[model samples]
Target: MGATTVLGLARRAAVGVAGAMGLTWVVRAAWGIPSAMGASVSAIAPVAVASARYRNRQFHNTEPSTQVAPGSAVSLLLSALTRQGVGRPLGAIPLATPEVPERAGALAVTWYGHASVLVEVDGYRILTDPVWSERVSPSPVVGPARLHPAPAPLSELPPVHAIVISHDHYDHLDRETVRELVRSQDAPFVVPIGIGAHLRKWRVPERRIVELDWGASYCLTGTGPGADDLVITCTEARHFSGRGLIRNTTLWASWVIAGPTRRVYFGGDTGYTTAFAAIGATSGPFDLTLLPIGAYDVHWPDVHMNPEEAVRAHADVCGGEPGYGLLVPIHWATFNLAFHGWSEPVQRLVTAAKAAGTTVAVPLPGQRIDVNALSPQVPWWEDVRRQ
Candidate 1:
């Protein structure tokens, strides 16, 4: 064939490939676009505007907080480029098969990595911030992917009395996860005020969504013994919320799960805030506390807690007694959301907890721990970090 004829064929092939790629991008974007942005502002506004925290058309923290530190954006971008492997584990992050009993324990917790946890209090099970999605972003094609597989499939979870959410962030409030739960479990989604809007948009039954402002509590009644007295409270947290560009249309919060004889605190995601003291005073002296200890950075100190801050926050939530409860660290060792060393959070957390005389359980993802039964500390992450 002549050079011009050969060139024409190559040009046609390139155009065909480009067209196919462009079509794939368009299809993926379309599939994700509807639910990715969550409920529209108007859909969320009515419930949000009535809250005391809502002012100037958005929710605000009791104490002032800047999501990002002023003048640090450029430095943060530069750091992101340079700190590539720091946030990743050197080897496989070990996973555990969760030992979920047929009946919920008096006080137990199953850590499923990141912010997803199953808390059992007085025989009632509560699942918090259950994100089974591989990526914690709006689009599946782009975002921080999970470093470790979810410890267990959502279908394997024992029937929970309630599913609680912390905020409307993609990581915590996953669309696909929610839809799956709706099909598999009949438990209600007890969430912060405006999050119900997103749930509603996703076609969650209104009867199944119980939205509350800070300090509000929902008493969930179940059929079996020790189930009627389970109370899930929406507590305060210093965190921002948004699934899209418009922020804080939904309120973010920590949670208190109080049963007949046991209490558990789920700190969905938050920075250290004084509100914890008030929460402890009114609702705590908890048996167990799940607090975030990852994805924290100096550039956004007001929203995410560091290891030491998590220790302090645990103390604050446990009525100012550092050793009052079992501290189980969440929001770490799953996704690389910040530029810290992969295992730095837990290592620092251990040091801080020991100094504070706090009892902590660092369980492998999917491991279930009975708070009543104490175990020796295991340095599992060390092996992964050393690799």
Candidate 2:
């Protein structure tokens, strides 16, 4: 009995020391949230407990039934651990050529990174999912850190008429970026329901934030009302959302911007669901479709679409033809959020799109390829990946 008691005491002391060191390391990490580490622990602990309870009680809960594959978990951990070692050349990367001056009256889109894009339609600019943070995690010290620096500072962006957010995921809705935007720009913030709570938490003015549910239409004229003709409507996205602690307490969404001349759809992260076809049947025949093509794996097939599904999604939204309009792939090249090789998503997308006779454009990050311009096949990611 005495021997067992002594062993238990020693084990407890060792565990306590290791835990203290871990806490110190997390608190002192170079990333952003030096002060909020304690708060993060409190926030996430309750959610984890709730998840456990829900899993036990709910019949709808699905757990990973199969055993974890060999080396899969190890690879994920090492990729995350050595994020900085990958060595992305930030300075040598080229900036995208702006097409705004060329396409004065037509709609144009400039992708910042991930789902963040600047869409200029009929002279009115709409910014979507603008994440300017260095990392996309609830905690700055850990989680999927960004591979490359932002192409341009958020402050350097031109005057945007409006800003749109798809969901409340850390990558999709960054708090720091939101605060900076609220202070820097005069544009009204458009987002799905419950995401406004986050903006309010960050002290954004109530009048500047507009929350919309699925199928709700909000009109946007030019600078002044009726200066230009454009209407933006919040549509549904088959995804989930949460920030800090709460999961799916908010909503995820897509947007349909109908210009006088053409209609466009932004499928803000979603799986391959029948909703796309329904959306097409209702407000589509889109001239252009911006789709996600990365951060997908077989494990979460119902959450994010792969490259092939992206092509099919484009066909469902736009007409089922290649030359019908244009398919510009977004949600990649900005951040390394997936387990696959960095360039694999676009390479696979290009091949699948070609087989389907779809006209796809893989623009370099920050580069703009005008739909009206005669596009030349410039495979830029090949050399970058080889490097």
Any idea what lDDT model 1 has? 0.91
Candidate 2 local lDDT, 1-387, one digit each (tens): 699999999999999999999888877564455322112333333333333222332211122222223447766576668653343433334456444453344667777778888887667778889988887875766666666567678877887878988877778888788889988998989987666666766778988888777788888755566566688898867676655444555667889988887788998887776778778888878877899998786545667889999999988877454556678888876676656667778899999998888888777667665566736979877777666
Q: TM-score each candidate.
A: 0.97, 0.78
Which lDDT tens digits does candidate 1 get at residues 59-91?
Answer: 999988999999999989988899866899999
Q: Where is the poorest 10-residue window by lDDT in model 2?
A: 57-66
Worst-scoring 10-residue span by lDDT in model 1: 220-229
* Top-lDDT structure, candidate number: 1
lDDT of each prediction vs. the true structure? Answer: 0.91, 0.72
Q: TM-score of predicted model 1? A: 0.97
